[model samples]
Structure formats: structure tokens, C-alpha cells
Target: MTTVSVNLPATHYDVLIDRGLLDSVGSLVAKQWSPRKIALVSDDNVAPLYQERVAASLAAAGFDVHRYVFPAGEASKSLTVLAELVRQMAADTFNRDDSVIALGGGVTGDLAGLLAATYMRGLHFIQIPTSLLSQVDSSVGGKTAVDLDNIKNIIGAFYEPDLVIVDPNTLGTMTQRDLVEGYGEIVKTAALEGGEFWQLIETIDSPAELISNAPELSARSIHYKASVVMADETESGTRQLLNFGHTIGHAVEALANGALRHGEAVSIGTVAIMRVFEDAGLAEKGITSKLRDRFAAVGLPVTDPLLNSPQVLDKVKNDKKNRHGHLNLVYLTAIGHPEIKSIPSSEIASFLNLSVTN
Candidate 1:
């Protein structure tokens, strides 16, 4: 078992990672809140796989458990789904004294955590992430939200989970695409702090391939993320470093009309940022080529954004992070170092257009 802590000013919590940890979640969680009724918020795909095990564990810990399963996907994250989730929580008689467990990937965790935050002002929650992406990012951070009217994570809040239990073995069922998507975030983060962490990524091109060899560093990614979020919890400032590939990534996903997974778009976004930086003379020699090569070696897309011009630009401009209408671009000087600049949309669009054109 491996453990890490996110010690923030207002929100402090611990994350526990271990294989077969689900069977012990009740005892592990019982250490936090004793009698809060437990609600397991799960997606349809995951409930059949491990929901019952979690329920049994919670029951053994001496709490009544309610499992609410919903269809899983980024599209399911929304006002309607959230409303239904709230109704289900209400039907379960959820209260501030009760707790909810997010028991799936990023979407499930986001929705479940948001529902917990809004229910009766606030409710206790735990994240039992089953996906690599969620295990390393969304499941730990307090940024929980549901898509509203097609905008990704449009309506969310900063509510930390009481505990995060990560069982890497659950990843056995994950697809290669999801694993690659997760690698994009991990590699981006590692590049943001290319120390031993980045070395860990370089040692293994495939995260799934690491499952049998290096589960510890896979869990260490959470520690890296925890440090970043703790320093900038509300994301009003430096926390944007975590948005390394996310800015244009979000735009790419929007351009795809939700056809691409979040991380895949992010992979493309990272390459786009690298390309623009190199072209503008911001990147070191050979750096851009290395980034592109590494990303491709991992099977991530760095050129998917070239498919559309006006759509991509429009999506990026519509992005809510563009405060003052200046695109705040997160770029890299090297792995473990980054620079955030606020550039005009017209200039960015033109730069990207040129990159796509030739």
C-alpha cells in the first residue's frame, strides 16, 4: 500500500493506493467518518464490475450503503444527469451527515463529487477511481463539475473528497486509448517537473505496461498532482500550470464535438503548444522534435487539431479561461519548467493557422 496527503489550508485529505483495496475501503474510510450513511455513486459500466464489493465492504464497516449507477461518459456529465443524481441522493435520504463515494472514472468522480458538494449544502465523499486518468488527476483534486448545455465541466465546485482509494488492478479492464490518454496527462505533468518523475515515464512508454513493473510511480503521479493543487487550490493563479496541454486540448475536444476523449485532445494540445513555441523561437533546439517523437511513441495525437481551423479557434475563444479575451497560453521552456503568457486570440489563431497550413 502507498499513501500520499494533500494538505491544503481549508481542505486536507489523504489518498491511499493499493491493489485489492476496495475490500478494505470500509475499514479505511471508517477511520474518517463513523456513521455517515454511505452512498456509492457509480457509472453503469463500473457498477457490475466492483460496486457490490464496495457495498459489502462498507456494510462490514457498519454503515448502510446505497449504490446509484448512471450511464457513463463525458456527455452524461450535465445538468439533467446531475439533477437525476441529486434526486437519487434525495431518494436515498442523503444528508450532510451522510457520505458519497465516487466509484468510477473521471466523469463519475466529477458528477459524484459535484452532487456531494451541492447536496444539503455539503456532504462527505470518497473517490475510488477505476481509471488511470482519474486516479492521477480528477479523483484527487477538489475540482468537481458536470457539463452544462454541452460545455465540459461547466458547473463545478472545489470540494475535496474525504479520502481517495486507488486500486491499480482495476486498470486491467481499461482500454489502450484510455491508458494513452492518461499517459498524456502524466507525461505533461512529468514534463512540468522532469525529475525522477519524468524518468519514470521515459522508462516505460506505456502506462499499462508499467502495471506489472512499476505500480509505485504510477501512484506517485498523484503525489505530484497533490503538491500542485495544494499550492493553488482554487486555480486562480499558478495552478494553471496543470493546464499545460488543457487550453488548446479543450478547444480540440470542442472542435471534435466531444468525439475525442479529454486526454486525447490534451495530447494533441500539448503537441500544438510545443509546435507554436518552437516556431515562435521559444523552444530550445531539438526540444520540439523530442516532444513530438515521445508523444507519438506513446500513440498520442499531436496533429488532430489541423482538421479544422475556424472551429478550433472559435472553441478556444469561447473557452472560459480566456479572461480579458487574451488567450493565456501555458508553454514550456523545458521539462520541469513552464511559462504562462496571455496572448491575443487573433495572434494565436494566425500562428496556429500557419502551423496547420504548411
Candidate 2:
């Protein structure tokens, strides 16, 4: 078992990682929270696979478990869905003493976390992140939100979980495409850290190898993210480094319109922005090539047709990171060295090498 502690100014939580950690979630959560009614929030896709096992574990720990399943997808992360879930919880007569457990991937975590944060002003929240994307990234961070319109994470809050339980075994059920999606985030994270970790990622040659090493890789990501969160919990400054590929990535994701997964879009976005860095001479010449090679090694796509779509430019205008007419983007001077640069909205096309009129 590997544990990463996110010691922040506001609160602290432990991200526990291992194979079969799901079986121990009830006991693990019991350490921090007392026995109470648990609203086990999950998606339709994830509910059948492991929800029964999870519910049994919670029952064994003497907690009343209530299952709430929703349609599984990015679309579920919205105010309308959030409101409906909240209304259900209210109908269930839930209150502060009860708890919320997120039992699936990123969408489940975001929805459940926000539900825990806002329900009756706040309820105990625990995360049992099933997907690799959630286990390694979204589950640990205090950021929780549902998408508003096309904007990602637009309506959310900084709500830390009381505990986070990660079971790499849960990833075994994922499709190859899902595995690649998770690796996309891992690649983005390793690119920012840029050293032995990056070298290790480069050494990984296949999806099987990635799954074999999921626990160690996830621990590294959690530790790295914890350090950043400790430094700037509210994303005031340094935490922006974590948004390494997200600037262009989010725009690509919005434009792809469900054709691409979030991590896949991020993989493409990272490649796209690295091209900008290379062209502007902000990064080494071969950096983009190296990144592309690594992504291809693990079946992650490095390019998407929508990456060059003019609609992407329009989407960038709605990005949450924009200040006035300038967008704050993470620029990689080299692997492991990241800097935040502000580009005027008009110049974004030039930054992306887009020929569209601004």
C-alpha cells in the first residue's frame, strides 16, 4: 500500500493507493468519519461493476449505505444534474451528519464532491476513485465542479475530501481506450516534473506495462500534486503549473464535443501547445517530437483535427483562466521548467499558429 498526504492550509487528507483498496474503503473512511448514512454516488456504467462490493464493505463497517446512480458521462457534470441530485439527497432526509462517497471516475468525483461541499452547507465527503483519471488526478485535488454550458469546471468549489481511497485493481475493468486516457494525464504531469519521473515514463513501452505499474505511477502523481497544492491551495500562483496542457487542452476538449475523452484531448492539447513553444523558441527544438513519441508509445493520440478548428479559438474566449482579454497559459521553457505567460486574446491565434482572423 502507498499513501500520499495532501497537507494543505485549510485541511488535510490521505490518498491511499493499492490493489483491492476498494474492499477496505469502509474501514478506511471510518477512521475519519463516524458511522452515518452514506450517499454512495456513482454513474450507471460504474454502478454495476463494483458498487455492490463497495456497499457490502460499508455495511460491514456499520454504515447505512444508499446508492445513487446517474448516467455516466461528461454531460452529467452540470448544474441541472447537480440540482437534481441535491434534491434527491434532500428527499432522502440527508443532513450534515450524513456523508457522500464518490464511487467512480472524474465525473462521479466532481459531482459527489460538489454535492458534499454544498449540501446543507457541507457534509463529510470521501472519494473512492475508480478510473485511472480520477485515481491519479481529480480525486486528490480539492477542486470540484460540474461543467456549465461548454466550459469545464466552471461552477465548482475548493472542497477537500475527508479521505481518498484508490484501488488500482478497479482499473482492470477499464477498456484500452480508458487506460490511454489515464496515461494522458500521467504524461502531462511527468512532463511538468521533468526528470527521473519523465525518464521513467519514457521507459514505459506499452499499456500492459502502464497497468502493471499503475500504483507506483499514481503515488508519484499524488505526491507531486500534494506538493503543489501545499504551495498554493487556491491556484493563486504556482498551482498553475498543474494546468500545463489544460489551456489549449480544454479548448480542444470543448470543440471535440464528445469525440475525445478529456485526457485524450489533453494529450492532443499538450502536443499542440508544445508546438507553439517550439515555434516561439521557448522550448528545445526536439521537445515536441519527444512528447509525441512517448504519447504514441502508449496509444495516446497526439493530434486531433479539431485542434486547428476556428471554433477552438471561439472556445478559448470562454476559458475560466482568461483575465480581461488576456489568457494565462503555462509555457514550457523546457521539460520540467514551466512558466506562466499571459497572451492577449487576439494573439492566441498566433500562439497556436492558427490562420483564422481574430
User: Whose lDDT is greatest here?
Assistant: 2
TM-scores across all candidates?
0.95, 0.97
Q: lDDT score, residue 257, model 2?
A: 82
Tens-place lDDT digits, model 2, residues 229-327: 999999888998898888778888888788889888888888887887787788888988888888899889888777657888778766788878988
> Which lDDT tens digits does candidate 1 get at residues 17-43?
888887898899889888768878898
Clashing pairs in 2: none
RMSD versus native structure for model 1 = 1.7
RMSD of every prediction: 1.7, 1.8
User: Which ranges of candidate 1 are over 4 A from the true structure?
Assistant: 305-307, 351-353, 356-358
